[model samples]
Target: MPQANGHANGHANGHVNGHVDGNAAPLPADLIDPRQVKLHDALHRLRKLEAAKDIDIPQLIVVGNQNSGKSSVLEALVGFEFPVDNGACTRFPTHYSLRRGEASTTAFIKPGPGRNEVEKACLEELSRSIRNPTSFHDLMRAVNAGLGKKVGMERTGDTGKGFCDDVLMIERRGPDLPQLSLVDLPGLFTASSGHQTDEDQETVQEMAETYVRNKGSMVMVIASAQEDIHCSSGIGLIQKLVRKDASLNERTIYVITKPDMAQSFASLKSVVDQFRFPRPAHFLRNQDSGRDRPRSLASRDAEEEKFFGSGEWVGVPQAQKGIAALRTALKEMLWGHTKNQLRRLIPAVQDMTEEAQRGYKRLEEAGRPDRRKFLVDVAQDFDRLIGNAVIGNYVNREFFSSFDDTSLEVRYKRLRSTARALNKRFATAVQEHGKTVVIGRPRPSGRPHGSAPPPAFLAAEIDRLYSYPEPESKCWADYETWVAGMVDDWRTGEPRGQASSMAYWALFEYQSRGWKRMAENHLKAVWMVIDRFIDLALAEVCPDDGVAEALRRRVMDTHVDKLRLAASTTLESLLSCHGRGNSGFYDSLDDPHTSRSRAQALISKIAELPSLDGGGSPRNAPAL
Candidate 1:
């Protein structure tokens, strides 16, 4: 079984590639593979550095049906004792970590609960169990004695409290690059046993789905005696575990425990063969070959003797052989590949960003107008009213003692009145300056002298000129750029309008080439700017009593209700236009770009509104 003359330098005990004491020489600098350059290279370098420091700990999770020796497996691996019983022993996720020299290892055990009240109770049970485990003999006695109590907590059944129903996370210190840690998932269907009432099957199913969805470690399923490992229940659970949305399949390992039962051990191979296990290899010899491999003092000899029959071992030789085979296979599988470890746990959000970029390009080609037109329009209006809008009679007066003393309510009311006045003045000016000019006459063919232009054809032309484009490439680019800019603002705390330029273009394209464009743009732009301004203003508003109290007092003393009514009405009208035919530039914000643009527009308007001081100044205005 030891492979005859297997020496320390032989493949069995040697360091990975056999470079003196396991350290290999560095690769040549010019060995750069272009495919491996840039981001991929950076990723590779990071993985290597992490691997060099030996921090890529494998998480081992133990899972099984009720009383399937799940806890025993953990105890045997760590050479310690975990509470065991005849029925469901562990109830929640428990983490175990240990240190050996400079290396470390971690393991996690995840379980389900029968009731909401039992969750916290079970978590405390797991914590206490790990901190104070019974002796090996006592644990063995408890297991053979049948379901006695909880594995980790002191309270039993209805009395347990404060248990968290989550997977256990364990970390053990060993070599810098320790073996993959283990995880023990709870029995698939037996989480609700000791409770007084029937459990919510839906709740358990949801919990199971949540665990599978968020699993950060390589998964392993436990196979035991009495339970048909190949039954629909088992296959269905395994199928659920393997299903994935990304480019790669979730890796799973199957372990057949309690092989001491001949019925299970005899047919385990046939059952395991059903599931496809990729990257198979073999190294260690089978124990049934009339010999036994010598294990280090780290292995539990007494326990192995008791578990395996007096004349025969308990675990399948194929299973044990499969483990070594699995290790070698994993090493070969992991060679040069940076994925599959825990670090990939953080999803690759960059992919979503790339998809958005492609969408944006298509939107640009759809013949939408740009946002600069809207900005220039607004700027022109400002140019016309600059003298009156900025240098109003009350502009020079002090409205508030300080930024903190100013009332947002008072500020909003004054700004609304001022904005209405300016808008009236601007409209009157435009009306007075209005002059229609005929550019050219139509190329008319023979027709009745008083016949009007064909109404149907005229309507068709109007529709063609004003209709918004269907959702497609035409809207995607602006959306992507908008979303990206919003993300940047979130990260940098910069004023949101920094990204409004893209949104402005998106809206302009929607409005100018369509009908009632100017009116729609105004409504949408004002709403967007108002939303953004409020967000910024609220951010500046101090949460403490001083500023909040001052503002509360001012609102009570002043007619601030009118200001709120105006802002609310303006916003409501803008929102109403969203997704309607007249919406044009102010279309539905379901798309990321639209949402971002809307946010920016709101911020811009809010910034333009008057400050909280009694003088009715702009909050963003330069100091006198």
Candidate 2:
């Protein structure tokens, strides 16, 4: 059996050279014990190979939902009692690699994805202090300790982390251990409870998904015999995954744990038959007596042999009975998977060679050609890059490869994505401050803003609009005082009843004119983002400063100015137009960019006016 090595995006333990030939000797086609030191050396070497992620490495990943007898099966397989019975459960992934040698157990921790250098170093240091684990219980404690002790982090209440994706790797060289290794993942959870949240459940689910999705990973899905098939989330996951890739059916194995605890053999068969278990499921009852005392592997095998020989399991083949047999079955499965990996070795090397040769040709090119032709190429490249950015295409691997978020090079390269984010923020700003007036009753005490952003977009503008302090002529005071003067201008000699009726329309028009001003501000803001994006795009497209500047001034600047002017002209026409041709609907907005909440708030306050819903010459305003 080979030891499984850890590899993250850009980190690895070591590198593998050409073909299947490297520091590791060629593995024989015949079945080998999975716990051998040589197999692990080969796997660890393969994991560090250049472009190794493109190749699927053989592994047995154990997965199940929380409290689904997942921990029990792992304990039974290793014959080392886990501390799960004492409130400690598998919170993070733990990968165990076993081999035969002078009895020694050493362990380490692999940082989870996205941990910074400082945190990774802290985890690595945690491993250095832990040279030996006297038992599996102590090994589990060390793992939890490493996971909980994040660098520069402090907390209270619980001593351990809620759930983490960080991996704990263990290597055991002992005279008594079996010849095998398996990856035990954090169990999937059904719902949020206790310290775990819905987010935590999702995290664990995704982690299990990552393992089972791997083509070379032989999944040991532990399904509880006592629970309904539908209730077991792991069964559901396997079902969906197998549907997507039918070949996953070949690698997946479902094992029913706690066969003795089921209501009856018939009831247990009902749970087992619900799912097409990929391969025939092996049913076994893990002994509960281990809880009071540690159970050795040899005793477990003897007890299982007697238990199966006298019961309904008597007819079951030796290949599908007990944890000891399952371990052998898994090792044989690995042997076949390894041979499959070797069959693709030569072709993989050929592809790598061709890709490298092409890369070399690109690197060797140098010197310049015709300046005009160069400029033309730059312009075409610029157009293509912009087109892709507009359409959200990232096919060009040269510049659009790395997504280092802090780099402006990466940020501006994604033109459409950047625009979408800005557009969302722009809409948010309009929703908050575009009204220029908030005419609702004062908010209730202790109530906070709900989902809506604060009026920070145009704070000064809103303040100036409401700055009216005159006795009988404030905009905030009600439409009456402001409309009183305007009412006389529109209908000087008309009856007071009719004059008051015209006041609502007058107030509506007065407030509507400000829409044009806000529209202009938003327009400028949009063009500003696009304009900055163009500059960044040009720099990337044409490395020559002179060529880039010439294009910016001659082509980009002129087209931008023309486009901006045309947009401004169109906006003017839309605002001023009022005729039969206008259906008053635009796809961009449900109600012409007017924030509906603000509009309703305004209507509620003004509904009390004598000219609106009041008894004195009550009249309706223009259609909103």
Candidate 3:
């Protein structure tokens, strides 16, 4: 690693192009270009602060089909021939940052997902004193080793998963370099054979797609002239995005590699025609023909020149032929691209800054809370929210957002409303089937054809109440006779006159049985609503999901359950008074007509049903 190395002094500076070196010394003004330096500086700060979540930094990315000479193209641009031989596929992306400064190189591994903390620390230490392409291979070996992969295994894990999002960064500063930022991504592969599997193909494809989607990044799509362009996944990938976002047509550079070996230049005619509209214009370039062949940047350029100077591409424009011309065009385009992207970048940063400011101001003036007090405050807040929900007070916008977000929650959180709804439905059901005998109205027949059914969310009480069988009717001549038949026979010690009164009480008691059922059901229904409200209230008041769940289990589950049992017992005891289970059926003996008038009203209510005696038996039995 060297610092402040520049080419104007005329020496090979032992580094890639002057791109994004963060610690490099400033170059003299006469030989300076600030676009790459300035852009990279902003990105470096953004990344260092970890504030780039909403922004896309400008970069150059290399992507193409597998074995499409993608690595060769990256080498010509970045000026280093990496170790891609001996089954060394680029298993992950390599992000190169080169700058014009003193001669030096710094390399590091950006650990990918799923690594343990110890592995991350070890991988982080690989950056020290790395100066060349072989160091890159060593870094990959370290990543694989930390991943517990054996020495010879280059790609897949034991589970057959291959490729990673881990990025290898190499920052270099040298005299021979020009300022440029570039990334070499894994080549897109299709067939899942050998070390690579179906998973590997999807991983590489996704990685390629993600890079291309970043509008700030310029995509260089490398295609081998020897292979059919139609089959090239790199070209196909970019073309797909271009169709969706037409502007990417400008950001994409379709470069044809290995032209020296291509049997027919005419095969790429369609690709050339479709992609050449906005042009730096060249698609053909040759960097190397064999592994570890072109050792220096000088030799790589020489080979490209030799190939184009003769043969099929000789007629191709000088502007459209070699790596030198391609490099110049990319530099010019990237400068303009950086300027345009600033329009979007500036606003995003301003928004992020404004959000930070609001966050700071939004904090309470009180200092850090005591642990005990924090728990108490959370409990009080939950209590207040539950109180509000029980009373139908939907004043908190935040609570409403949580409670009404989904269709079910919208109508469930308000406890009072849920109770009222249950009560109304229960009242209607009682009216239809409450009396043993009705004078006018008949029970509804089976569900009407094509008619809408009751709401799917009706309370459990409603369904249970309907499921029990409707009572049958029997006939008797008059009230006294009916009472005589309904009464239990007088015991040996009991008086005969008291038998008529006791039997009459039993008759009226049996008729009011639906009230006990409905009242008991209403208690169960309200408790059901209470359970749902507690869940919603927890979400609204206690923002921490884990705490809300814990509170529900520890407090609400244990205590609320006991409260429900107590409440149900109290309601059932009260409701049992309506039927024979309580002391006795009480009615006014003062008005002689009072009992008869009430009995007549009951008859009118069920006039459509079979006529009935006020006592247990019907005067006219229903026909079979």
Candidate 4:
């Protein structure tokens, strides 16, 4: 059993700590611990899964304003001088996954699935170009060229600007490295410059937010202590995100760069002590400060040691002082987050497995060669659906029972309810209008007659005949005039009998016209219900494009059209008989000889009409 390395313990005491003395040599090959190897292997597995499945792995995101020493902090931690330049060096997010292994660096592009064949080919070509770059500088140049060429940003044409949301993943493994994953986002900018427009600024902000806003990510907001912290745009953005989700405050860490250049130590200490930001703040002094020159690894290590050993910083806690400390903290935080994320990931994997199984089962069922059985099953299903619709038994309680449930089933129920309500409204309109026809009297005078006048049959007939003025109906008016002339001719031949028959015919025609209009409205309402139900059923039964088209042509379209035509014909015949041929019409009248008895009988008949249930279906519905 070998002891784990300092990197595995996340204590920042191995190569980083050993280098502080400026004389500690690299760890020997025999000293490479098993525990450290296991951790690295586990992380590597996770990275592979994340890449292959496009899963989100837990990460620490380092974000700061341009020229705020973000690159310096990263270089200090990784001990690698990443390519840096003036005027927006980073146009894409760079992810560094550090681990302890053989001393080597490798880089690759991770494009999203939305990329086209051309973009994929371009990226592959770019990857090969920098496959074994002699230096980081060569790697950076290749990356810029690839991005600019693919996005058409190398030219000033109308295609695109230089900015993109693509990512570059670099894996650096060395005997001295810590087990950590870090994302370096594009630096925040206050204004547009050169080809960068206001839109470019927005793009950068969106990219930064996309990383830090991930619940699985731990955000590190970096700012130079020499600059007013208030001006740190990155800090303001982090604060805004934290405000929306206060739980983020627990995971966010603050890094103050260029601590050696601060104007007043007391002010800096006060800011740290007050903890106004409600997150731990660490102060760091990079190797090269206030100079344009680059220093060697040994020189950088000496600088860090000298600063931490000085009286100014020696009193500060080890956890809040150097790049090594930052690395340790990030490793520990990520390890914990990864454990929790893995626990959550288990259930998700199971769910995905079950869904896949279901899909496979469907495929197997579809592949069955028994075509006749499949057709028979489909026909039976359709027949059951039609029966349910007609009888109003298809209402799904899960959907219709709750107003909050807004599924398709609920919508279909509401549509059917509307059609039924319209039918009831049609019935009510017929009943109400018929009452006026039966009463058959002139507009009532404010003063009532002392006694009811004997049924003025002749006067009532006259009033009812002209009551419905059909200005738009030239043919109807002509027909009514011809009927009235026939009545006059009959009146001349047999005065008493013809008058009685004329009054009855006038009332009959008036009610028939009103009932026909109402019945037509009801028929239209039924047709709407049938049409909508068919559409909804088709969508549910045949959601796939190929199947839906075939089903519509072979079954739904033809079946629904035939049903609609049959329903229309049945309704027309029913309405004609009910309005013009029913014997009940005579019994419901107010003839002088039997007015009182007829009124009593009409009330009893209405009482016997079947009631409409909550499902909108009529109980004991009369046969049409």
Off by over 4 Å in 2: 1-41, 48-55, 78-85, 131-135, 151-160, 175-179, 289-292, 349-624
Quote model 3's TM-score.
0.50
Worst 10 residues of 2 by lDDT: 2-11
TM-score of each: 0.34, 0.51, 0.50, 0.51
Sort the predicted structures by lDDT, highest score first: 3, 2, 4, 1
How much does candidate 2 score in TM-score? 0.51
For model 2, what is the C-alpha lDDT against the true structure?
Answer: 0.60
What tens-digit string does per-residue lDDT give for candidate 1 at 1-624?
Answer: 122111111112212111212221121111223343343334433333422332332343444454444554443333333433333335445544333234322232334443222233334444445432223224223322221233223333454322335545444433322223344444455334444123533333454455444444444455554346654233355566555533223344455554444354346556656666442212122121113223331233333444443343334343343233334333333323334542542244344446557656754664445434533454453333333323433342333123343354333323344345334432322222111211123213343233222222123322322223322232456656655665454443437445444444444434333223333333332333233333333323333333334444464214333553565576567645643433233233133334455688877776677777755646563321
Steric clash count of candidate 2: 8
RMSD of each: 27.9, 18.8, 22.1, 25.1
Which residue pairs in candidate 4 collide? none
Name the better of 2 and 3 by lDDT.
Answer: 3
Residue pairs whose backbone atoms clash in candidate 2:
1-33, 1-34, 1-35, 1-36, 2-39, 2-40, 3-40, 35-179
**Could you tell me how far off, in angstroms, the CA of residue 596 lies in candidate 4 after the best superposition?**
97
What would the per-residue lDDT of candidate 3 be over residues 1-624, giving only the tens digit for each residue?
111100112112232333323322222221224546766667656744545655777788999876777765665665554445433567778887766677766666777664433334335444442434334445455555543331112442453336777777777676655566678898887788867888778988988898899998988888777766678898789878888898898787768776655556665555566655466456545443333232455555665678778766677788777876676667667777887888998898888889767655544443346545766878898888878777878777666555435456766665666677676665555544565543322344764233233334653335753444554434434544655656655223457655555454556666665666666655655665677778887887677665678788788888986786688688877766555434354452112234556777776655555435445445553331
Q: How many residue pairs clash per model? A: 76, 8, 36, 0
Please say which candidate is ahead in lDDT: 2 or 4: 2
Off by over 4 Å in 4: 1-40, 50-54, 86-88, 102-104, 112-117, 155-161, 273-275, 289-294, 353-624
* Deviation of model 2 at 314, angstroms: 2.7
